[model samples]
Target: MNIAYPYAVSLEEDGVYFVQFRDLEEAFTQGASLEEAAFNAAEVLTGILAYRLDHNQEIPAPSAAQPGERLATPGVEVQSALLLRQARAGRSLSDLANAMQTSWPAVQRLENPHHWPTLKQLDKAARALGKRLVLSLE
Candidate 1:
């Protein structure tokens, strides 16, 4: 799934610009100008996704952009959580649990948005999936 979600920008009567994500009703922000609004929109989106991830809530897939829509991406943490789940491919959660020397429920929690994973945990998970964990600072 694409990290960046589409948003609708609108100018209010007070001359402030507002941004709301089409796929995320909980994500919204405003700024004095279009540029600032867009910037704030990104921050808002990241926060929303982070909260959902932290709460083990479902993260919606980015919707296709309509006319005049802008896109915003989630933060690295959220991306990592998602990638960990996606890396499983078609393998059952139980398979990963066995690989990690744990129970299936434990493996499931690793993919849970609300379950905060440490770096070492993520590294182990990547290895279990036959992948390497790579990190870079943007």
Candidate 2:
């Protein structure tokens, strides 16, 4: 379940680099170099998702990477958001709260990208959702 987003990158006439996610209309960022642009892409994607979460907006599913596009993999905060969203599909907050032996507010906070949840807490949430939390390094 890699939630990496595919984005188009271009060089502007002013020698600035631009990155945009076709799936997310609100996401766009610029940088002076490709490395910075790529970094900003991840940051922008995370920010977009966080904003949506904060405002209770719908989060669109990430599309597959096509040819000639860069992949912007979100950090742990965004990844947690994805996991929590998937875990909540077809379920109720009370159900999850009961499964995790926590309060509804706590469960909601767990899904909040602005909140920093520990891996242990995430693992517990995964188990409550009948999923396992796994980690890998590249």
CA lDDT of every candidate: 0.80, 0.87
lDDT of 1: 0.80
- The pairs that clash in candidate 2 are none
- Candidate 1, 57-122: lDDT as tens digits: 777778889989988776666677678766887788888988989888877777665567788888
Question: Ten residues in a row with the worst lDDT in model 1?
Answer: 72-81
Judged by lDDT, which candidate is best? 2
TM-score of each: 0.68, 0.94
Clashes of each: 3, 0
Candidate 1's error at 62, in angstroms? 0.8
